[model samples]
Target: MNKQTRPLLTLDQLWQFSLQYYSAREIKEACLHLQNHFHGNVNLLLTLKWLDEAQLTFAPQDWSTLTHSLTHIDALLRDYRDLRRKLKAQVSDALYKETLHFELQLEKQQQTALVNCINTLELNPCETPQLVEQYCLQLGAERLARIFIQPVQAHYHTP
Candidate 1:
């Protein structure tokens, strides 16, 4: 994989990278799998991938602070996600779609907070796999780490 060496310096760049990364069906499935099965935070996982692509390493203290700061937002995201999933079959299609749209907005908010947290810290260059592996280990989701680190399927293209 040809990883980007330059760090993403703004929230827009991180959000764009995330949108492109998440657009792949396989990538989306993998992320959802991790989220559902391993109790992973999708936005945090995506942020790790973004940082990995830039070859940036988050110090342990910084990682803790970042996660701490996102606690409230994460709780809200989980609540909305649960509500969305619960309403999927019980509600009208339009209502379900509205819930999904609101959930996506929360996701963007989480990403924005992630970018803001990282922007204040001093990060160092590191091997891409190491950074991702560390995060996976932290989440106890080492088995699914490869899905985030490996390149997406050949058929997927950036939009």
Candidate 2:
């Protein structure tokens, strides 16, 4: 069949072509299909598609929102970790402390928001949302780590 007369390509086929040619719109369309198929878990892939799509619009305000959201999520996770550590140290029983530690680890593994945000941002940094989100995640992690850890400073001595 001639190119113009050929049947419309399925999203999967379009995705393959897009990958080979770097066609942003085709990739974006395929990602939307994947997003629908996988629910919201594929936000990163979807974000990449969005960024690559020539038709997609990237506004500055959207960047601010995306960045703010990522920062907020990272801060929340860090705060939760701190709270867990504090509770662990305060506990008198060794068994309880161990249990708390295990629980905290489990809780952290269950955290998808931060992971998804990071993945999405990294997929397409040229876009406002992707760039801002990545920056926020990086900065927030550094700032939080530095601002906390008072106990470590007071108790630990480097030899």
Candidate 1: C-alpha RMSD to true structure equals 5.4
Worst ten-residue run, lDDT, model 1?
Answer: 1-10
How many angstroms is residue 84 displaced in model 1 relative to the true structure, after the best TM-score fit?
1.3
lDDT of each: 0.79, 0.38
Quote the positional error of residue 159 for candidate 1 in Å. 15
Query: Candidate 2, residues 13-52: lDDT per residue as tens digits?
Result: 3334334433344434433443244322123332333344
Instruction: Compose the digit string of candidate 1's lDDT tens values, residues 66-108.
Output: 7876897999889878888887889999988888888888988
Say which candidate scores most in lDDT: 1
Query: Which lDDT value does model 1 have at 53?
Result: 79
**How many pairs of residues collide in each model?**
0, 0
